[model samples]
Target: MNVFEGSAGYYGRYRPGLPPEAVALLAGAGSPSSRPRRLLDLGTGTGLAVKALLDRFDDIIALDTDVEMLAIAETDLRWRLPAGVRLSLCHGAAEEFLPPPGWRADLVTICRVFRWLDRPAVLARLNQHVAPDGAVAVLADRSLWTATNPWQQAVRSVVQDFLGPQRRAGSGVFPATPEPFGQTLRASAFSDVTESFVPVRRAWSADGVLGYLYSTSFAAPHLFGDRRDHFEAAVRQVLGCFSDTDTFIEDNTFVIHLGRRPA
Candidate 1:
């Protein structure tokens, strides 16, 4: 659930490759000249989202619980950020941090990491930090649409063949659909709660597909242990059927739910 620690090295590897909704949500949140004076990126991971925020905010603070992830985030900022942008990297569970009394922020965003917690609780927590008349965006990708791709049969065959009950019992790739998730936010005191979906198609080669899966926690045990070769072989067998000219299309659906903090 700690995406910062989970997706460390792979962070931002797919840059310029994010879902369209992600870009749109960022835009809807506002631009540099008009962006909120203060921005909070919860569960920031390696800070890619926050990096974008930095372009807007004169001061930005990103917090994550994983030390390893924050370490990399700090290094990335030093190496990649332009001068004059104030950045602070805090290490701790996001829920543990409280905005100072009477403190409210212009923007509060959690991208790709909010679904890991109990939805209602997290929404309530995020709502507490938003400035009145301010906005919040919770960004997520629904990976289950991969089932619509031509290769779904093959990939499911292998996963069902090897991972069996685990696949069913463990968390499925996508979290809540757009509607229910938005309702959770509405219930937590956000007004004008609206959900928008963006469809993004990511095309990757056979090896790229396997690499993406191997990067996941579900696949890591098999990817790093005795079954590593076996798992790779199964993935390759399914993906290798594609021609070099052919690309595997993964339907990356991002749901953006926005609400205004009541005045």
Candidate 2:
């Protein structure tokens, strides 16, 4: 069950883009002096990170398993790239994607979607494709469902009432990451791992929250089935109870883990 099959519209429209500071941090990691840099972005749903770093890379390969997600990403990046910046959108999973013969990337980035992949295998694949001096950056942040705000709690509770207490991924429940992402990276061929944190504050309207919910696998509109309208109304009511202006703030801590293959 591919949860992102038909949710690309919501994902492209609602999911937050990478913060400017985070983008700068990634760009500043290292730059090759001889030629333009190349980037490979795995699990690039809707291309948020790709869009942010397009200007810095000479060529970019954005890969994802969902066709709809790649379609939306293509549309989003169609006219946004700078002159001479080549873009290739591939449809595939991270575990099995193979770069072109002799291709190597200066940077490989996985954002928000890394937890769903086979970590060790993906890292191994990246190690083969990344330049010796290049790095792999995994970006992740706490979910809105885990926020401690009253409104966030109420909204999550309503979702639980409609769905269940556990998080849903397609037809199955999502499992917690087997171990800390850093630990997994360290255990892989990428042994030089470092981390950085960026605190982000955002305000969301009720509609924004609904859009965000629709973008995620766990509280998607399809989960409600025939009760989708009821679920929306209930969520609106819960949010309204706390937000007079129908806007709620989310304080998130975004983390980036950089992994480099030992020289």
Candidate 3:
């Protein structure tokens, strides 16, 4: 089964975005031209990141491989954007995105989705669309599976107890360790690679945690099969042991790796 199948709704509701200051930092990393700034957001997910960037870019192309996810973003942003601002939501792979003639992306964001792309091919593609002084930001925040909070651990334990140990992602399994995305950026054509971390603390209630579980590729609803309700119950039971009211404070450090080509 596709990991993202039936996961779009949950993703839009539960996935947290970068903090406002971090969004400002990401927007500032690029040098866009006057009048209309263009932003190419790859793996736009629910368009949450694009929504955060509405004021940052006048012309935005939010692209995603998942048609369902892109549709949701299109629906949400269509109403939120001011009149006259250009918003084009494309449903396709990042490499397939062809902007209008003379359209150059001032900043391109690959948020929490490096696992889904061919790193070298994407870099090569960016060289064609991105401006000479443009910036590319690879962004991500820890998910429940990777989070070390006591409540998060309990949730993972419950998921493993139901899904049987190996973490499933799409048709295969996720790596036991984290991928080195920064190394890939450093080796790409975009030079001046730098890393930054933005700390954002959030509190998750039982409902929030439960909703987030279904958003992940590893713990997606289909992975539970007919036992999804049972899995939720088990997760709730385990979570109760962690907090009385079933809420947990999670301190997340959002990561940003910015790379830019020489002007």
Write candidate 2's Cα lDDT for 1-263 as tens digits.
78754577989999998988899988876454426688999999999999999888888999998888888899999799999998999999899989889888888899878888998999988878888888889888877677777788898899889899998876678777568788888998778899999999999999999998888888766778999999999999999898798879998888999888776
How big is the positional error of residue 154 in model 2, measured in Å on the Cα after superposition? 1.3
Give the TM-score (vs. native) of candidate 1. Answer: 0.79
lDDT of 3 at 161: 94
RMSD per candidate (Å) reads 3.8, 1.2, 1.5
Best-to-worst ranking by lDDT: 2, 3, 1
Candidate ordering by TM-score (highest first): 2, 3, 1
lDDT of 3 at 64: 89
Candidate 2 regions with alpha-carbon error over 4 angstroms: 30-34
Query: All candidates' TM-scores?
Result: 0.79, 0.97, 0.95
**Relative to the true structure, how large is the alpha-carbon lDDT of every model?**
0.62, 0.86, 0.83
lDDT of 1 by residue, 102-221 (tens): 655667777756656566666677667766666777777654223567685576567656666254312333343334557767777776676878878777776665555544444433
